[model samples]
Target: MQEASAINKEHDKPPQITRGFWLTALLILMFIANPLTAFAYFTSPDVIVSVHPKATIGIVYFFGVMSTINFAIAVGIWCWKKWAVYGMYLSVAIAFVINIYLGVGILGALFGLVGGLVIFLTTRNRWQWFN
Candidate 1:
């Protein structure tokens, strides 16, 4: 009986997308928005100067890279990879620091941190397949 139960468990289908996937998908849209906005800075020096008077082109490039990383995190979570949990935490920490540097406020950063933790913890049982 034990052997039969174990075999049935092994044959069970993987869990479907959890709340984490939905949250990550939402984050993906926000991340894409950042890069799209950065393009305006790259295209027009006037916008860059007006928005960030003391900033250089490097800042715009940096935004592009960060946002791309954010997108990758979202994708990783969607795929249910273990790395996604770490990436989400790391990205939030980085973003929190950057936001403080740029004076953008920490609410979003806090949200990311807390939300990522909740999602990661709640879905941890599904991490059995992860390396």
Candidate 2:
């Protein structure tokens, strides 16, 4: 009877995270891209053609700072810090709204969106972490 209970408890544990391990790694990688793209967008206008160079640079700067913050949160999440999970969600949501409003066309933002979802979804069931 005890053995059966132990087996049941083991089965109840969240699926061991093997499936999302790659997604988790990808999310970590996404954090690195945040600053890279932001810098590129900021510098690209200096050497490249754009309808609104100044405006683009300024917008990129804004995203750059935000991305830095998001990247930090990603690291925090990687280390199993609880706030990183939820704080990042809020941060990404804000970034998404701002990026969409500004008409930004960087792929990193999409990765952030998907990566945030992956972390939040994967860890959502683990209440102990939240505490």
Candidate 3:
């Protein structure tokens, strides 16, 4: 009876994550790294300024905000929470808008497109884990 119960418990676990989930997970990791990249930028603005000295203090603050937003979104995604998917989409949109104002929106738009796809695939599977 104990053996049968144990087998039942094993079967109750969620199905194995697919290859698409792995790719989506990788993207989530990248999203989580945003803060670290922002920190690096904050510490060494010279590198950025050298490329374009016009980069201002405001830009640093913008990166800081983006870092916080990305971190929160990453956490939500990690927990497979439903709100995280919406948060990810919102962040992508904000990123593109900011980049557009800065005259380099294309990369952010690209990220949004790819990240949207990843989020869709990931959430479709793990969404059941959320409330």
Candidate 4:
């Protein structure tokens, strides 16, 4: 019976898009963005244009804080925290739409769109998992 139990564990269902995939994606994004932003500043700020300057600076700050927080939440969710997973759901959805609305660039929007698709595709069918 003990041997059977161990064999059953080995055959347990595989993770749907294992958390490592998302976390690695977020890390790669963070790495790529830093150098890309700097290079854009030096080489040509015009390559990837967005909306014009605004008075509040709220948009800039919102983008910055969310990126960092999202990274943390990605890591946390990968570790299997329920709250972090929920936050990952809410934050990614809100950020995707808000970024699109706030004039964030296309590549960034693509990342959000893919992230949303990943989450939705993996979880949407699991009705019981949400609660």
The top-ranked prediction according to lDDT is 3
RMSD of each: 4.6, 4.9, 4.2, 6.3
lDDT of 3 by residue, 18-123 (tens): 4365646755676758878778767876676565454667786677777777777777777666787787778777766666666555865576567767777666
Candidate 2 per-residue C-alpha lDDT over 23-128 given as tens digits, one digit per residue, 9 for 90 to 100: 4776668677877866765666454336434345566667667767777876776666788778878877877776565555567457548766777677776636
| Runs with alpha carbons beyond 4 Å of true place in candidate 3 | 1-20, 49-55, 105-108
Candidate 2 overall lDDT versus native: 0.67
lDDT for model 1 comes to: 0.64
How accurate locally, in lDDT, is each candidate? 0.64, 0.67, 0.70, 0.58
Query: Residue 58 CA error for candidate 2 (Å)?
Result: 2.7
Off by over 4 Å in 2: 1-23, 45-56, 104-112
Please, what are the lDDT tens digits per residue for candidate 4 over residues 71-126?
Answer: 66655545555565677678777777776675667678668767656655554444
Judge candidate 4 at residue 45 and give its lDDT. 32
Question: Candidate 1: lDDT of 71?
Answer: 66
Clashes of each: 0, 0, 0, 0
lDDT, residue 91, candidate 4: 76
Q: Lowest lDDT 10-mer window, candidate 1? A: 16-25
Best by TM-score: 3
TM-score each candidate.
0.59, 0.62, 0.66, 0.50
Off by over 4 Å in 1: 1-21, 24-49, 106-122, 129-131
State the lDDT at 32 in candidate 2. 77
